[model samples]
Target chain A: MTGVAGVVLQVLLVAVGSPLLVGVMRQVRARLEGRAGAGLWQPWRDLRKLMRKQAITPAGTGWVFRAAPMVLAGTALVVAAVVPLVTTESPLDGVADLFAVTALLALGSVALALAGLDTGTAFGGMGASREVTVLALVEPTILVSVFALSIPAGSTNLGELVAAAEANWLSLLSPVTLLAAVALAIVSIAESGRIPVDNPATHLELTMIHEAMILEYAGPDLALIEWASAMRLTLLLGLLAGLFAPWGIATAGAGALGLLVAAIVVVVKVTVLGVALAAGEVFMAKLRLFRIPELLAGSFLMALLAVAASYFLV
Target chain B: MPDLTYTELLYLACGAFLLTGVMVLWRRDLRAVIRLFALQGLALAAVIGVLAAHQGDLELALVGIGVGALRAGLLPYLMARALAAGGEDRETRPLVNVSASLVVAAALAMLAYAISRPLTELAPSPATRAVPVALTVLLVGFFVLVTRRRALSQVVGFLLMDNAITATAFLTTSGVPLVVELGVSLDVLLAILVLYVLTNRIRASFGGTDLDELRELHD
Candidate 1:
């Protein structure tokens, strides 16, 4: 796998595998609750049906409302490109730094929030407000978490950071990594609008946070938004896997056998993570919207500890 | 390998100790404060034990054992008993809000680094690099004392302040002299005894143990 080919494969992996991961999680969640859930191909089927249908735009919404889902999906695709999935050397390696990645995610969130406000509904307004607040709080955690790795990596670039971790795999065993991983995991769940922050399977108007913004979208637009969010989840989990234990991510110029092994390793890691996350979600209830900040604060504290440990210890 | 790793562990434990002091400033629950205080003490003892091991000093290892037993264990146990008997399980108000105190703690940490830079340069040891964390803990401990309302929490803050000093002395030089360690640990036990007695008196006199109630005595 050359650099360009590896980057293309990584992008395709996220775009194609994103829906399946969502489906697997749903099935796992359903099984944990003692029922046969939708099959693993359900998200693809949902996307197909959605694409065939006509998208309806609301009467009183502007271009931002119409454009939000595209921007959201587009930003997610860019992030997928930048994040190393099954390769150590990305062509976009320079731009795939931590701060750049976070800023892109923030851009998507802001676009969605603006769209939420543009809809002129109380639910959209409230959800947008909540999303921005949560986003601001979680940003520091992500920064500190990433900074903890950067301390040893000597650079914030995701590629170099992964390389640094891979070079000294023992650092991954440090208490700093433990704290950062926990912080990053919690931040990932909240950022992706997963369980405990906002339930993906839910659309109860009163309890929904992410869905409130998408309430006005009808057919294809809704499909795009759904796919985009799922892709973001896939990319984040992939990033986490790459950072913590990227033992098998194919490097540039690796043989086909290496790429095959990388693919299998990535699938196993992501599947295990998806199932673990779904299983964990089954036991925990969605926290109150107010309480979510407290959780994020705790995550920030953990990340702060990681940063402090790296500073003083390492 | 063990010496280098243990020295690093000592530095990380110093961070934990500082974090616990900041936590006492952040949390309002009395039990949470006591738990964090105990964690700080544990971290303190771990730092001592790790450094003692790295240096291979038997006397310092003995002091580490004593610190773990008294500072981390016996003292917090006694404090928990006092808390239960006093029945003031929450610190309802503070002189400053949590967010403000967090900012102050950060600023004080910066100040600690600035003030300790000369000392750190003088020693030029890996352990001396953590002098600021020890100083930050000392400052934040007093911040906790000033902000928190509960007498038991204030006592924990006082203990935290003392622990930070111990950490500073240990990190900057060899572990504090053995006889001094014994004397200070005893001083802590006696201080806790007096604070416990005073807390009970505050509770019995004013029907609560909040330090704000003590202000009523000035009138």
Candidate 2:
């Protein structure tokens, strides 16, 4: 029961912490651009403001449009619950595997895309179509890269994988983990609607994919989707950290004090990653839709090489 | 909830194979077929999940849930939107008829059983009851890929085949190493994405995504 209670606490921390990671990243981006940004609580403030504003649905939109934002945010919460951030063991951990996490992310994207098209706007349809096209390449790379790591860990349970990484010799030299980490990093940039895939800052209608879909969203509805998107970005990066750098995750048998320290470490690591992403985005340009596939394919090849290297080296 | 028995899981796998096979034959509506495919994915996930839980292998349980989420939830959602956006919402009439597909499906199942006999013999797990069912699904998926005229159908078939392979891995080994399972599913999803892109192009130039029309590479 204590173990179960610990898992619950870990999930709550991730849920609240996910938004903070976003806040910190935004602060970092602002700093890099030579402008003082909003305080770290800006996201929460934005969400409150959006909630107070009225939602103006596009006339052609139906139930899917109304429900899409909720589902997107809902799925993100579920994914957050399942993924290990501060601890190896989570309550909802066994409800899915790592592949499931990818699927959940993909599922959120699909819902968002469907909502984008349900409005019957050309931009909406175009954005949805392009989103799937880019994702097609990115999704596999994420999976294969993770596979490279799982082989060395010898388990699919995210918790077990973390534990294995802590316990194994192969964990050190597994080129697959490195390849997967790199591949996941690329996919995260793409998946999160960051630079070199789609620009989060741009409203250039022709180039926009993620922004185009949400162009019609305003107020609280838009706020949830945006927050969820940020959380998704943080979550994927946190997953990369958890799986690849499990040094600080509270082991299943660790006490409450150990988990507290682990949670702090997770915050520090995710904050660093968030800052790095902001820096990377500041320096990069969004790739054309056609060119994005090449980027993801490169990640896939790297992951494949990692897996191959693992087989020979480990 | 008493632990789910191996026999129940076997039934679920067999049912999944049947539903997916029938979906290939009965549906021409792309969106409808995608929904059916999602259901088939759920069935596949259920079988794996139950088996994993029964064995108390947390890793397998995770894989089962993950497979369910991806195959059942995400892929189908993507296909549905893609079909809708392309305005390719019609039922795809294949080169072959429904009756022929059923016959082929049965034959494929038999072939799978025959081919899997040696492998099944060597499998140490008691969950081998679904071994033949898994193989048959794979074979049927291949048949759908080859015999179907529509690109979407072929892709769905290809995915079903991948699910069959995943199922086989589960039944034979009780589950794969988590990372390997992750890699395989990722590969399968990636393959589906590639197929989706190709289908989009095929639809754009050819006005439809019929496999018969994709003969530009053919002499």
lDDT string for model 1 (B1-219, tens) is 365566557666776777677778767788888898889888988888878878888888888778888877888898899888977788777787665666577677667777887997786777887888888888888887877888887897898889999998898886667688678878878888998888888788888887777764454
Interface RMSD for each candidate model? Answer: 3.6, 17.8
Q: Give Cα-based local distance difference scores for all models.
A: 0.83, 0.74
Cα lDDT tens digits for candidate 1, A98-119: 9999888888888989998998
Model 1 chain A is weakest, by summed lDDT over 10 consecutive residues, at A305-314
Candidate 2 has a TM-score of 0.58
lDDT of 1 at A45: 99
Residue pairs of candidate 1 with colliding backbone atoms: none
Q: Give chain B TM-scores in order.
A: 0.94, 0.89
Leading candidate by DockQ = 1
User: Candidate 2 overall Cα lDDT vs. reference?
Assistant: 0.74
